[model samples]
Target: MLRVGVLVSGGGTNLQAILDAMDQGKITNAEVAAVISNNPGAYALERARNHGIPAECISPKDFPDRASFNEALVAKVDSYDLDLVVLAGFLVKIPEAMIAKYRNKIINIHPSLIPSFCGVGYYGLKVHEAALARGVKLTGATVHFVDEGMDSGPILLQKAVEVKPGDTPELLQRRVMEEAEWVILPRAIDMIANGQI
Candidate 1:
């Protein structure tokens, strides 16, 4: 089985989708071994606890510096002996050392079709806001391998969601998450877990 460690920084709706997929047998040959978040208040941790999955908080705020925090984060990830790491709305920039260690073993779920509203300064609702401001007719989500660069990894899967007329950023964000993010993220995880990637 593929042991996965999930990193999150928010409500973990994507994480929940993954868990739900696993529960419904949509994903095979894998199991979530642990969940970690930078925010102690993150509901992702709570979700993990409810599922009886090991959860931890290793925030940069708890460390003296970024380096120390990175080291600790790496140590925490290593402790799980994970086969894969998924960033499900994890807001923190991964340490270069961790990226090197995990290499292609790490993947992320971006809010938009990458190479579009992705890269630096684009995340969460900001991505949807940009899409709305640009008056895009279509927006989507992407699952991709994580590299040293910002959202510049090789794409694995993508699914587009429509941008409707008079849609606000928040509404579009929700639609993208429900229609695209929630769907493809789990599919990507299943693909990776089953060695189809």
Candidate 2:
């Protein structure tokens, strides 16, 4: 089985989806080896614990620099002998060194289509708010390979959610998240597993 490590910074809704998919045999030949978070209080940790997966925190504040924190983070990920690393709602920008180490093996789920409303300081509710403000008829998620650049990786998969005329940010966010959890993430993982990505 391909051992996978997940990183998260908030409530683990996406992580939960991946866990459910794994439990249901939707993601063949893969197992979640560990979950790591930068925020000690992130609910993703709780989700990982509930699944009996090893969960850990490596706060960026505790490290002297990005490089040092990344070193420890890379070590933790390596300890799992991971075949893939999934960033599920993880908010920090991983250092270039760590990105170089993992390269194509790291994947991230972005809240919007790439080259669009993405990059530094764009995540979670902010993404949805931007999409709504832009009068976009459609908005969704992107699952892409992680590179050193901020959300500027090669795209793996994308799922679109229609933006209704009267949609609130909360409603659009919920819809996009549903597509992300049930569609985009699974397809991306399957593509990787099948050597299609």
User: What are the RMSD figures for all models against the true structure?
Assistant: 0.6, 1.2
List the candidate 1 regions with Cα displacement exceeding 4 Å.
none
Per-residue lDDT over 108-134 for candidate 2, one digit per residue giving the tens place of the 0 to 100 score: 998887777999889889998999899
Count steric clashes of candidate 2: 0
**Candidate 1 lDDT score relative to the true structure:** 0.95
For each candidate, what TM-score against the reference?
Answer: 0.99, 0.95
Displacement of residue 147 (Cα, Å) in model 1 is 0.4
Best candidate per TM-score, number? 1
Over 33-87, each residue of candidate 1 has an lDDT whose tens digit, in order, gives 9999999999999999999999999999999999999999999999999999999
Model 1: lDDT of residue 157: 99
| Worst 10-residue lDDT window, candidate 1 | 111-120
lDDT measured at residue 20 in model 1 versus the true structure, 0 to 100: 99
Q: Model-by-model lDDT, in order?
A: 0.95, 0.87
TM-score of 2: 0.95
Clashes in predicted model 1: 0
